[model samples]
Target chain A: MSFIQRAVKVPPNSVSLEEARHRVFDFFRAACRSIPTIMEIYNLDDVVAPSHLRSVVASEIRKNSSVTNPKVIDMLLFKAMEELNNITEHAKQRHHIIGQYVVGHQGLVQDLGTKDQGASGFLKDFYKSNYF
Target chain B: MALRAALLRHVRIPAQTLNPALTLTGGKWGPPSLRWMSSHDDHLTKSEVTERVLSVVKSFPKVDPSTVTSDVHFQKDLGLDSLDNVEIVMALEEEFKLEIPDKEADKIDSTNLAIEYIYNHPMAG
Candidate 1:
């Protein structure tokens, strides 16, 4: 009940790139702070530590590092916040968290050797998840 | 009116005057060391804070452990970007169980500053 109330209370849109940057850091801190509860709810203790999860979240944000527009950043932040809210609220099941964040885009087989060097790009993508 | 004026004149006090006893005791009884017992006495030493801060920085995945030192800059020296800087600060916050304000957190760009800030923080433990 309170979670819904808190979720709906959005701040005004950031007017400048600087403001948006600060907001991103705030969001990052908020996400990092919630790692404990997320781990507990999803039973991720054996799989991931808080620091590792923090790095993963950082890397996810780093993927979009080229974006310079404040409005676009705000939109992206909203989506990230929504995803965080869902995860923390237990809207996601254990396997969902494990698959998306824990197992990662690499899928189950973390090939470190040259076995996949000869495989076609399509086959590699097929082996990986459907998402880009 | 006359009585009131006389009372006012007699009751006036000087600005520079202070209680001698209060000054002698430093506002409390006994010597300064024995005046109060607190957990602050066991605050983390500078060496311990340095070692812990270095360990946290070295443990960061992007940072090369061999390149990390007590005075290394997160961005300029370690080749990390701004986001990595924030991430390292967050890691330090978790390690120390301290919630550093964003303003102060922003200023901690190097290992020296992180060590100094944590060492000086009274509630860092």
Candidate 2:
């Protein structure tokens, strides 16, 4: 089991409060990186222009205005983290991590919707494999 | 579509109109009286500075402001942990258009305190 996961229960049943906190934070950190990874993969060259990206990013940041379901956030966070953990490539890791952070975060990810195949299909594939 | 929607949503919240409480005074940002209050409000009047804050802060569907009060600690009383604080700060800043330096932001314990700060702020006057 991962060093971090060990703090939680074995067999992945119940996570300690402390472990849960770390898991939430670590999950956010890793998922924040996932955005650019998908961006680079899809090669939307200048797809989301910097100026446009700024607005897009702002909406993403504003996603967590309400303290919506923390459970959903945690689930997504863990799912995103798992995706980043599985990647073997070198250059893509950075992008993957950043994307993960943006989408995984509370407010930032809210503005961003999962319309793009890059985020949904590919990213989902990453999450499903790792979460299991 | 999602990106467009998110951008539009943020664009809708005019920062200057933020702090629904302070709007009555027709000013933005906060006043200086805020530095005097305690860390949290334990008791006060119906128009208690903090209670007024709760009235409006809770209006937003996303944030349940009912839990707020003078004694309502920012993190504990209100469900606002950290990011919520950041968002509230942003909303407040946008409403008042005043830079609540991180130092002062930390001092804002209740809605009343926030109102006091806005009331006496140089910008408010």
Candidate 3:
């Protein structure tokens, strides 16, 4: 499933304090890896600037410095991930509208009326629709 | 005018050269200007920095490539808080092979920001 879909399985306010404490570090690790990707996706116009992204991340970490709850941290991190997914997905769709995201959508080619829609079918349809 | 709270504590970045992924985030490595990416240039190339970083993060049981993003909150997004930041800092320090001051720990939140900071700062070699 896509990133946003995972949020449905989690309750927003259900962060367990114990989990929050242990999970805070895990959240940071993921955030660090994701920064570059996030920068690429939301940075379409460079309007927000990389510094702002960094600053917000740093700011969030600062607030949780004292929290020892792992679950709480996990839920918080999960929320951020969901937001990022939503924003980026929206950005991708918008880009599709403007034709900027065209090349990447070639994955849809296989989904065309080809007999059996397998992964290859999706790719074939994706290329035909998006590329051709 | 706006007060910035302590974000993270001591995120250590290694002294080693970073990969294209992290290095590219700064103004180094390639042409100063942005040109269209060519077929020869796949975006996944990593420098020492990237490898070291990936090593540290990949060691963790939680992070997946799909879930990583710029806005993923360290605490909320990846499930990290202050103390974990400490471990992250130490790992980065080892990976990049440098010293990250405790005082500076709170400031390094995103890898993009860290790359930007490191590029501008004196320590990144």
Candidate 4:
């Protein structure tokens, strides 16, 4: 039996230059506003300041000046959204100290009040090798 | 063309050697010139680190400043949970302008530990 491969269809560019520009500007503004909160939650305030985040985003926007191509703008927007999602996820994970400790321990000990168990045999072996 | 070349030559050499010359040239050339004048006062002493660490610990809403001492532990003295401890470490990292590695960060359970870490860090400014 012969397998047929279908060509991926590229979506038509429907967004106007003004709309794309506005979207990019809005994305930057939203990202800038959230930088402080993201930094606080993710413990990145030391590494990344609000102004630094803004300048970085500004540089990215300036680097890509293909406003005429809506697809390019869409790709940029999608990347920005993905970045925001990643930061948010990191912040959420790192916001609590317990999670940080558990993660740092290389998942040896699982959390309390949770049925999720770690590698109990490995943990035993670790204790035997290290302690005994 | 000759005059412009001479002017460029006059501006370029002094800009590289002297900051004041660069500033003067920068003023003349508007914001187009890339004369990066970075100030060099980014060193923090041990005493400053101690003070900053104390301040950061004290600033925690749950922690009482009157009861807080350098030797006080986050969990035992301040009654802070692990989350609070993480936040405190993060605050110290922000205050000291340095990244405390996960292992070291975990070990910083007390104000004194945080102070010592920040004080020893060469890049903490």
Best by TM-score: 1
- Estimate TM-scores for all models: 0.78, 0.32, 0.32, 0.38
Best of the two (3, 4) by lDDT: 4
Query: By descending lDDT, how would the candidates be arranged?
Result: 1, 4, 3, 2
lDDT for each residue of candidate 1 in A1-132, tens digit (9 for 90 to 100): 887777777778999999999999999999998998999988899998899889889988989889999999998998899889988999889988887787788868555669868787888778786545
Point out where model 4 deviates above 4 Å.
A1-132, B1-42
Q: Rate the local accuracy (lDDT) of all candidates.
A: 0.88, 0.49, 0.51, 0.63
Q: If both were scored by DockQ, which would come out higher, candidate 2 or candidate 3? A: 3
List model 3 lDDT by residue over B31-122, tens digit each: 76566464324322235445545455545444565665433445566776555555556556545545555447557765555444444444
Could you give the interface RMSD of candidate 3 in angstroms? Answer: 6.6
- Residue B73's lDDT in candidate 3: 44
Query: Among the candidates, what TM-score does chain A have in each?
Result: 0.83, 0.32, 0.43, 0.54
Specify the highest-lDDT model's number: 1
Model 1: what is its DockQ?
0.56
State in Å the error of residue B73, model 2.
1.6
Per-residue error (Å), model 4, residue A64: 42
Native contacts, share recovered per candidate: 0.77, 0.00, 0.08, 0.00
Report the number of clashing residue pairs per model.
0, 45, 56, 0
TM-score-based ranking, best first? Answer: 1, 4, 2, 3
